[model samples]
Target: MTLLDFDSDRLAEFATQVRGDYEELKAKNLKLDLTRGKPSSEQLDVGEALLALPGEGDHKDADGADVRNYGNLKGIRDIRELWADVLGINPEYLVAGDASSLNIMFDLVSWSYAFGNNDSERAWKDEEKVRWICPVPGYDRHFTISEHFGFEMVSVPMLDDGPDLAAIRELVQDPQVKGMWAVPTFGNPTGITFSEEVCRELASMETAAPDFRIVWDNAYAVHTLTDEFPPIHDVVAFAEEAGNPNRFWAMSSTSKITLAGAGVSFFNSSKANLDWYLATAGVRGIGPNKVNQLAHARYFGDAEGVRAVMRKHAGSLAPKFTRVQEIMRERLGEYEVARWTEPEGGYFISLDVIDGTASRVVELAKEAGIALTGAGSSFPLKDDPNNRNIRLAPSLPPVEELEVAMDGVATCVLLAAVEKLGA
Candidate 1:
């Protein structure tokens, strides 16, 4: 029965049992962590061949450019061609960068603040106030970048198919609303892929700001847990057809596909946006690490090679995800005090406990030596308003440890709900 169905006395009795379970969990002194969506060692091992790539003076790229030296600010054609196919964009519009896509995103915001983008009337810094559309239960890191830029983040509801388009359409009527952030495919925390209709609207929608941009961070573009990959729409092309050629600053990386810190990063956009980025990025450095880019290019010979590796990742990750769901179902399903997403492609499961009880649940888990991503982490400024959303990352832990951690988490969720109800 659901916890709400229980009388005060029965609830109290059940709370006693849950408290006892929590006590046992605490006594175990587990050091399990479900904090971040990091790939497990087993998953990382699948890309171990990357370490030995482009070895023994094998540094010439497709155009015979010496990758050992630096000059191609647009990145090597070899790697760009590989990822362009994966990202569904033209190689000419794609700029291969260093390992971290986050860094590229940061630089884009910083440059936009300092100097205007391709179509900007003026630099963002000149604005009275810059506001950005943030879809929540979203990526905390994306929100972090917005906060770093002093942008007033406006929260929009992230729906099953994508962010609330009706709300986004209304919000963009303000000239102060400069940009929005989107994951588009297998979004962080929520794993919700934007439908083609949503993509088309985002591409075609009218906004008051001429320079309005969307930071399309497709981090989980190919990180699928199933045989079928989600359809990757060419939103850049959509924007072009809609006369908003500079609307999207698309980004993707091999960070999760290969070594987290050593994989290549990519940025795709219109020709004008690419030119603007290169003009500023030229000042940041001569170019990205061509050697590492070459290594990645040699490692994954083509788009299909990348897919083959992802299949191996799915083999390792699917079981852990399944275990998390099973444990949650077994332990907390009947209580009906919490709900979580069943993501098919991404690394995180967005969990919502009873309203106003998420923080308590996290605290209970921590005291039991299981670390969870802080409650409200999926919202802007770390504010959930309801204090109910929790991002559960089941990718980093093995199935055995994940099973234990998830059970403890379920116990904590139940305990927190009972405590809130009792009070």
Candidate 2:
């Protein structure tokens, strides 16, 4: 029966059984974490060759520039070409950066504040108030960058296909709404990829801020878990066609494909934005870690080589994601107490639990020694207005441990549902 259809007696019986299961889980003293979408140790092993690259006096780049020296402000040309191929952007528009794309993103925001973009009226810090459109249930780190800079974050709804363009079109009418954070492909925690229609509209939309930016964080561009990967529309091509070439900042990294701590990061956009970024970033440092960039270029060898590495990642990761879905289906499918996304490529499964019970479920899971991403973390200020969505990161755990942790999570969901139903 549906949860709402359960009679008082039936609800009471279900609650009692769930309470018993909860106690048993507590007794086991199990410890499992589904907190972060970290690559498994097996996944890390796939990129081991990156460590041995550029070995024994092999320090010159393709153009014979000594990589050990520091002069290529836009990074070495060969590595830039490799990433350009991997990211499907023109080599001239893209620049290689250090390991963390998050750092690159932070730097972009900081630069925008210190010195406005190529077309801005003034530095963002000089504005009376700055606002940024943030899609809901997004990467917390993305929200963190805007929040840290004191941008008034406007939460936008994330539809199954993409962020609500109708709403975004309207929000951009205000000049102070300078930019928005977007993960166009396999978005964090939600796995929603923007469709071609959405991409075209985003590129062509009218915005009051000439410097309006779309921080297109394509973090999982090639991190597919299945053969039928979702098609990612080219934002750069679309934006250029719309005569808004400077409207988007495309970012990506090999953090998941290779070593998370040591992989390369990239930023691609219009020449104006690229020139502006280079002018400011040049003042900060000479160049990024070229030795590491050289190693990555050789490690991947070419675009096809990068695909091979990602395929190996899929082999190890796909099953863990599948197992999580199967358990959730078997245990909670009939209860109708929750719903979740079965993503094709991303590292997360966005779970929306019974309203008003998500916090209780999280509390119960913690008591049973199973850690989950805290409720409402997907929203700005770490507040989910409905208090319903919970991000489930299944990539970190092995299948067996995931099964155990998921069982405890299932029990907590049931117990919380029953309590909320007043059984």
Candidate 3:
């Protein structure tokens, strides 16, 4: 039975027992971190072959461009084609860059601030006020970018299918609303992909701002942890078909696929958006490290090569994710003080604890030296209005470590819930 149904005497007894367990955990002086969705050392080892890639005298791309030297500002064509095959977009639509897709996203925000996109009345910085819609229980870094630019961040709810489209439709009536962030496939914490209907509706929706842009950060497109995962629909095509071709700026990277810091990053969109982005981005550099790009291209010969790498990643990742779910189910299943996601792909599992107790649970976890992602990291401005969500990052730690940490988490969650009920 859930704590909500527990009689006063039973709840009090449970709370007292949990408090004792918490004390013993604190005395252990343990140290375990689950704060970031970083790849494990074993996962990193899978891509170690990339270090020796594009071996001696192998500096030329397929088009005969000298990768050792500077010139192709947009990126090497062959590499773009490889990524294009993965993203299901044309090679011409892709622009390969250095390792961080987050950096690419920030650059677009900066560019929009200074110059605006082709349709803007003026630079976003010059506007009286700029606002952006942020789907909550989302990637915190995405919210950080909007905050960095001084945009008023509107919090939208994230449903099982995706962000609430009806809410989005209502919010876009404000002309000051300039942009939004989306992690369309296997979203950071929630792990929900947008439905095809929602994608098309967003692509075609009329916005009060002529330059409304969607930063489509599809970071986990190929990361599948289950056999039954569905392929994501083509949002770029959906937008183009709706006659809003320039409304999107899609970004992806091999940061998780190959090496976190050494992999390739890419962006894709309609011709006008690409031209606008390049005209500004080209001034920032001669070209991305083509040597690195060539190394990745050779490392993954084609689309199938990329898929093979992700499978190896899943082999290591699935176990950790499974262990987290198992521990949560065993410890909290009967009490029902918390609920968590069983994501098919992606690096996080989102946990929603009893109302008003998530922060307390994190505080208790930290005292035990088991580091979890801070309470409310999934929301814009780090504010979980209900204060009920906690993001569990199981990828960074080994399974044995993750299991122990999750047990500690279960204790904290149960203790917090009982304490709240007693109050």
Estimate the lDDT of model 2.
Answer: 0.89
**Per-residue CA lDDT of candidate 1, range 1-423, in tens?**
799999988988998999999899999999999999999999888788888988988989999989888799999999999999887788999999999999989998998898878778899999999999999989999999999889999999999899999999999999999999999998989989999999999999999999999999999999999988888998999999999999999999999999998988999999999999999889889999898898888888899989988998999989988988898888889989989999999899999989999999999999999999999999999999999999999999878888889889999998999889973
Model 3 Cα lDDT, one tens digit per residue, 333-403: 98888888888999899999998999999999999999988999888889998999999989988888888
Against the reference, the lDDT scores of all candidates come to: 0.92, 0.89, 0.90
Best by lDDT: 1
Q: Which ten residues in a row have the lowest lDDT in candidate 1?
A: 414-423
TM-score of each: 0.99, 0.98, 0.98
lDDT of 3 at 359: 97
Give candidate 3's TM-score: 0.98
> 1 or 3: which has the higher lDDT?
1
Error of 1 at 202 (Å): 0.2
10 residues in a row with least lDDT, candidate 3: 226-235
Candidate 2 Cα outliers beyond 4 Å, as residue runs: none
